[model samples]
Target chain A: MRVLVAEDDRSSRMVTRRLLERLGHEVAVAEDGEEAWLQITSGEVFDVIISDWLMPRLDGHRLCQRIRRRENDHAVSYTYLILLTAMTDREHMLAGFEAGTDDFLSKPVDEAELVARLRVGERIMKLEQSLEAQVGELRTANEKLHADLQAAAMVQDSILPRNLPRDKRVSFGWEYLPCEQLAGDILNVIPINPDLYGVYLLDVSGHGVAAALKSVMISRVLSNDPLGSLLLGETPEESVTSPSRVLALLNERYPIDENSSDVSFFTIVYGLLDARKGTFRYANAGHPPVMVLRNGATELGKVGGPAIGMIDNWKFDEEEIQLDDSTRVYIYSDGIIENPNEEGEQFGYDRLAELIAGLGMCSTSRGATVVAGEARAWNPTEEIDDDVSVLVFGGDE
Target chain B: MSKSYPAIDQERLSAVSGGDREFEKELMEAFLEDAQLRVSQITEALQRQDTEALRSAAHTLKGAARNVGAAAIANVVMKIEEAASENELPGSDLLGEMTGEIARLVDQVRSSGT
Candidate 1:
């Protein structure tokens, strides 16, 4: 090992240098702390430093602190510091530790104990190097995972309905919030013709890259033709346009593959709204009930059925409600209703429907805010823990 | 010559020198020069009644002597440093004994070729 010996007395410095050189270490002698600091800063890395506590220009404690600061900034390896002093009091020892001295030795140093202390320092430095390498590896892997998730989120966003089925017969308002970088919900507004419209919302079981990927796959297949898996028509231009037929076809094709335990199922609500004839046809696959706000009353209805991909050969039901020009239709996921506050009380169905009914005929964005804002108001400290999606389709005048 | 101060073990110095007579000679010569300068400073401080300078010179001499395996000289210097630190002067007889021992050690190392 390369060692540095700093002492004011010429004879003592000579003795220490000779002893260390005899112990198989190359020794550098410094007259005082200032000279030793100059050698340390000259880019020569010494493995061990044996310095007298009392010296001119700078003290051993101060030198140890400066070395520690350099180590923290440069970060290659640790330099062992051994403070040599004649003062041997408990208070002095404690002060040495606070100043960052690694070890201590008395004046007229013992050659045997000095070598033994150096060996201990070598072992500690080896362990530190190993730990630093492991931390570096983990940081790199975490950054890669974060980048991959961000890219997947972008791909998922591109597949959503670019513009809600636009027409003078009705207006649409909607909002979607994902708890993380990715979400599990998929909704679309497909136009079958000038008079017919198809609206549906589906939610996968979990949130993340895997669940978002599943939703994207379903979005690509949701087309208004015989070629598409969702809302398939018997002919190229003529769609079946019936809520039950669309869901039944979906159930028959995408039943849970029992051998694959990793497969995820979903709950959904599908509907066909005919603005020209003033009729709504819809089916529910174990999703939340669709709300119909007419006149002064709020009506809740559900065409009950098991969530799709859960059970094989399960039948879905369709329900149609007579909606006037003043009436509004709301389709949403369970995230809103199931949101819990600090008191553990859910923002249940009654409160949600009542709040929306009071919102009247505002834009979908405005109404969605009121409901989302109410959830936040219930608890400031506890944020919502799940994804929320709301689609309001109404205003046929 | 009568051996008055033998607290310094010759075997310890030989072991530290690793049986190298030339290195042992160099160490003794360096220690002798350092001791001569410190002894003068201590005697001057005593003549001027400067307790701080007396204590400091004695402390340096004591540490330097012990480093070169001169334990007997180191112990005497230690007593002088302690006395000066307490604002008391060491006995004239003790001071005479310490200077005489340092002179004898230097003369023997100078005359005896390693």
Candidate 2:
């Protein structure tokens, strides 16, 4: 190890230098406290500083203090400060520790003792250097992991519907909020035929990465021919006309597993709206009830059976409602009602029903505006926990 | 004439040693060499207008001096380093006094040949 020897006397400096050299240590000589300080601060690395207590222009105690202060001064290694002191008083020793002296060498210094102290200083310096290097590597790894997670989130978001179709007959609006990097809610508005439309809202059992992956799987399955037909309960002849059977078939096909004990099931409300027939036929598998507003009156559509995937061979009942010129239907997942406020109260179903009723009393065109307003009012200051989906359909004038 | 020894001021030596020859020699050596190096660096740092370097150099020198029993030199270096670090130089007379003390110590050591 390279050591710095700070002594004011020529003979003493020489003798100390000889001692350190004999121990196979590199020694740098400083005539006084001030010079030793400069040598150490000059971007030079010194493992230990063997300094005198008394010197011209900066004595040993002050020198040790200065060296301690410089320990964190640069990007280089650590420096151990050893104070050579003649004063062995308890109070003085305390003062030396306060000044940041790592160790003390009593005057006149013992050769063996000095060597042993240097060895300790050298070992500590090596340990500190290794620790610092490890910390830097860990920081780099953390940054890379964060970047990868961000990239995955972007890909997940890209799989969602970009924009719902805009037509005079139907008004579509939706909101998606993820509690983490990914969300479990998935909504899609796909045109099954020229005059037929398929609209569904699905909420996976949980939030975050696992739920998001399941949502993507459901999306893929729904997009396929056989699974799509099965999920929609499409028959060879009546498949295009009825959406209720599609949901029933989905429940029958993929029953919820009871023995596995995993909280991984989804609730969905899917409907097939016929523009020419002025009718909406839907299948509800234990999802939030849909709302039908007509002539300033609101009614909640009943769910036909238990939620999809909850039980095998669950019969899904179908509900058909003829929408008059002044009628509108609203469908949503449970997230909006489940939103909690700072008061710990959920934006319950009652509030949602009231908001729908109030909007029906007002006008059909203001349906979207009223629903959003009510949700905000329910939890004005809190963040929404899940996704919100609202679809409004108006009949021909 | 064992190595033509300088007339040892027994009283002064004993005063510094506390009845230890090795302690006296170590104290004298640490004081002279540490003081001179620190003072020289301080002078150079001041000439270069490097406030940080000047302060640090002076501070280390001060601590080292105080450690081995040179309180007077430590006090001077502490003041210099602090002033330089704060961008304030002490008066020329004070600096001269410190340098003069350093010279006297060096001369005393050289003549004594301890």
Candidate 3:
């Protein structure tokens, strides 16, 4: 153990130093409490300190208080303090403890008692130091985990379609929020032909790493690239896919087994729009109800079926709605309506119908932002409880 | 310097010395030099008529004096410290007496070392 003896008197300091050195410990000397404070705070580590109760510039009580504050900084280890005092009254001892003193010894210190007390303090300090090191290791590991997750999230964002195929007649807008670092929701825009465009919104069954990996796989197959994915035709000249065949092809590729505990599925709504004729054709899986805005609000729920990747050889029904210059359609995942407010009341279809009616005059991107803002405001925590996705497809004004 | 002051607690000093004659002599020499410095500080504070300074100087001297087993000097300085802290301290009379005793002890330790 390394010991520091702080005293205003030269003789007491020398005597204390000689006694401690005789006990097989390294000794550091301080002329007064102020010097002791400087040595301790200047990054010189010591295991035990024997400070006089009364000092000129600083005192034992103040030194103990400052040492206790250093304990809050995890980088520093605990130091055992033993204050030497000539006054041994009960009231004074109580005051010493209140100022963070660990132990006390009377003046004219006996050599045996001083050695014994230092050994006890050293043992305690060793235990505390090991515990502090363990905590530091855990803190460093936690920081690494957070950084890795953030990098994964950035990679996922890079794969998303940056800008939709430039079209003069229609505009596309969307909002995506993940409850964790990786989201289960994925949306994309693909150019099917010069006049037709395909838009898809898919939500995996669960959240976190597995669902995020599955989403990346599904996005690759649905993306506009034809050379790598199985969904496209062999010739580069004919790679675009039809809207109804999109879900059917994904159902065949996405694996499913009832016996497997990890078997999962996803919901989807794939739409094809013809800007020249104002025609919209779509295939809906087990997702949220799609709204068609024209003279008034109307939900197209007749073309609904089970989520994709769940049934084999199940023919998915396709429906088409003739769009007009005033027509704008909305397709989203179950995340929006399923969100519960503080009163446990859900933001249901009726409320969403009312919201879409009010947003009839806004642009597609502005409308998506407004809808997401209203849904989050309905909850007390202002948190989207699940992976939220909103896609609004509308005609240009 | 005089020998009228009370004798130091030899038993306490011996326990600290651990029967080492050379170590005892070194400690006594250091104590005497330190005591002289403290005596001057108390005398200066009394001349300045600063009660707070008197309280602080006496209090520090009390603890250091006691550490060398000088019970008589420690006792008198302790009284002055307590009284001055409460602002009821006596004047130069008490300060002179304590400084005189401390000076005499310094000389006694010096002669004994020879």
Best by DockQ: 1
**lDDT per residue as tens, model 2, A173-219:** 55554444456777777676666677777877766666767777776
Candidates sorted by lDDT, best first: 1, 3, 2
What would the per-residue lDDT of candidate 1 be over residues A274-384, giving only the tens digit for each residue? 878777889988788988887746788768688877777777778887656677788888887887777899888888878877887776657666666775565555446
**Per-prediction TM-score, please?**
0.82, 0.60, 0.75
Q: In TM-score terms, which candidate is top?
A: 1
lDDT tens per residue, model 2, B1-114 = 212322233553444345666656666766666567777787787788777878777766655554444445556666786688679876676588677656655676567565
lDDT winner between 2 and 3, please give it: 3
How many pairs of residues collide in each model? 0, 62, 0
What docking grade applies to model 2? incorrect
Best by lDDT: 1
lDDT by residue (tens digit), candidate 3, A1-397:
8899998778788778878877888999998888998999888999998898877799888988888888766457788889998778999899899988889977777787897888789888888888888889998987886776676666667766677666778888887766654667888777766887777888888655567777787878776575565335545676555556777777777757678765668898887788888777888878776877776665655587778877876678888887766777887777778878998999888888899888885788877777876776777584565777788877786
Best first by TM-score, ranked: 1, 3, 2
Per-residue lDDT of B61-89 in model 3, one digit per residue for the tens? 77767777777788778778888788865
TM-score of 3: 0.75
TM-score of chain B of 2: 0.69
| Positional deviation of residue B30's Cα in model 2 after best superposition, in angstroms | 6.9
Error of 1 at A287 (Å): 4.3
DockQ, ranked from best to worst: 1, 3, 2
